[model samples]
Target: MIELNVAIKDKYYENSETAVLSQLDFKVNSGEFLAIIGPSGCGKTTLLNMISGLESCVGQHISYSSNSSGNRFKKNDLASDCSKSEYLENEQANRIGYIFQQPRLMPWLTVRENIELVLDPTQFNKIEGLLAEVGLAQKGDYFPSQLSGGMQRRVSIARAFAINPQLLLLDEPFNSLDAPTAGRLRKLLLDLCREKKTTVVFVTHDLQEAIYLADRIIFLSDSPCTIIHESIINFPKPRTESGIAELEFQAKLTRQFPLLLAGKID
Candidate 1:
């Protein structure tokens, strides 16, 4: 089943003559991990902002649907200005989870409190399990400042999954960390997604990261971004970050579009 269908005819910055994204379209399947990778300013973030309703798709040729069963972001509903906090409410039971570039945890709150903040009262009970799942069970009482960057990121992952969201959006959530830390977190994310049966739409500029994580990847062009390349990772699950198969696949991609993987648009 298709979990998300996004077709944004075009997006532009106010007072700008050039379009940031044009004729962009993509769909994510239920329980599948989809990654979008492109150069630095290819409207990757803007595309996510539109999907999460942080950016208005008003007066544009954008059509987004969360799944017919949930009917989220219906074509006519594109005008709605829904903020991230506004989505934490149980009222929007569609449960589309999102992990921003930063951990975005409140400093004053403890790790547990940070997770509890986004969850409904009924889900507060999941905090302990989630904390353990993210390897932060003992640090639940620790503040965000007390935790390492990777641990803090784990909290963000836990918070998003706490909602048991059917669709999760991540915007370069691991780009800043060291290789080992990011690798561990990536493995954690993979485990959680599988256990929870979550469908993910991950955005990144890292070619290997996308290759290591996604079932399929969509590469975008530069400004006026649109799909430039599509590749499906056929290696079975239980794959390593730089496994032989992954490296081989990555090599093939690099050979085919050397410029594209280097964040130079094809």
Candidate 2:
């Protein structure tokens, strides 16, 4: 299980010193797909950063309880207490794979090289298979510049999975893509996640995307963001846009969207 309860302060804006995240308390089950939806500038990325250990908090902001050992590991002291290697060596620490809003591929490296850079040397054999899995079978020699934006994002997805992470964090990865490209990427992501059984936390402003991709959806209020609605998506997996756009499914979400926006969820 994953647990988080924290407050965030913006040092640059001291005049209005309210916490960016007033009270965030939630838990994620192992191997679950959880999507967080909120308005822009609502601290969604901040929450992901905290979970990934990119941001530090003074108190007990995040904790991971391993199901096997029943041991709880805290993130509060990570930065100050351990070196990068030590942290990775800790059995309780989660191996994280993050896909940012942009592909962020290395401009100088070939597609294969970029993916290879993050994998263990022993796992080099898996690179070709992953490239093929992402539909870039013959493009391994091409650099980021040679690939289209959508292809580059595919490379990024392949790279993230190359690490064989236990937890995956995605921050609006499809935000800038066109509709058709985004749809394909979403399906690719779902296929990969199901194959790997990785616990996923996806943050996005797109309601349809969240509803289609997640096992459970979390809705947050505008900044000083907090969970206003937590909903289970009963739709079966391997969902497609056509299926989600059906009148019945759309109507169900339409009715819930207003309550979610109004923070009227029980």
Candidate 3:
């Protein structure tokens, strides 16, 4: 099982102290998808940064281990090692993969080349196979500018998975696409991640997206955020559009939305 533990002590902006995130704690196991949502400026990204080790924070620890024993509350003494730290640190070279809000592909590179960019020289064939897995085999020769937004995002997804990273971090990966495309991509991603046994930490505001993809939902409060509520996605797999709403997953999340947004109705 892949496990993640995040604890934030304190962080400041400039001379003034700002507790963007404080005392945050959560764990995710292998093949498990976790979603985090909150209002803007609520430090949701800040929390992700700490977990990804992009920014340093006080009083927090981020640790990873394959066994469940490695995920417990006990602090990992090995976190201090430079190599281990680099591996766990924010978006390590190939061990941890990130899919940002935008596709961010290089305009000059074709889809195949873009995916192969991160791979080792000997691994180009692996990249070809991954593009096929993501249903982009036919578009391999197309550049980012030549493809639709959804297709570009698909390439981004393919690149993230090509190297076979242990942990995947997605920051609103499906934000701008049309509903149908986003839904399709979501299912494809879930299936692929499951097959790869990769632990995913997805950040999104869409409740349905969270319900359909995550094993659990962690909701954060407004700025200076901490976990406000958490719900386990107990619904059976092979989720569907109509059935997902019928299962009360949406309603359950709606009931918590107020608290999640710090009591704001909007």
lDDT of 1 by residue, 60-169 (tens): 43333445567654432333344435434422645678999999999999999998898778878879988999999899999999999999999999999998887789
Report how far residue 62 has shifted in candidate 3, in Å: 0.7
What are the per-residue Cα lDDT tens digits for candidate 3 across 1-266?
A: 45676655555555666766666777877667899877777777766765666765433566766564654444342233335455444334327778889999999999988988988888887876788888888899988999999999899999998878788999999999999999889988988888888989999887777878888988887767777788887777778865845358677667756455452434
Backbone clashes counted, model 1: 0
Q: Best by TM-score, which number?
A: 1
Q: Candidate 3: global Cα-lDDT?
A: 0.76
Root-mean-square deviation of every model: 3.7, 3.8, 3.5
Off by over 4 Å in 1: 60-93, 262-266
If scored against the real structure, what TM-score would every candidate get?
0.88, 0.84, 0.86
Clash count (model 3, backbone only): 3
Please tell me which model should have the higher TM-score, number 1 or number 3: 1
Model 3: per-residue Cα lDDT at residue 108 = 93
Better of 1 and 2 by lDDT: 1
lDDT of 2 by residue, 48-82 (tens): 87778776543433555445355555442333335
- Model 1 TM-score? 0.88
Best candidate according to lDDT: 1
Per-residue lDDT for 103 in model 3?
A: 96
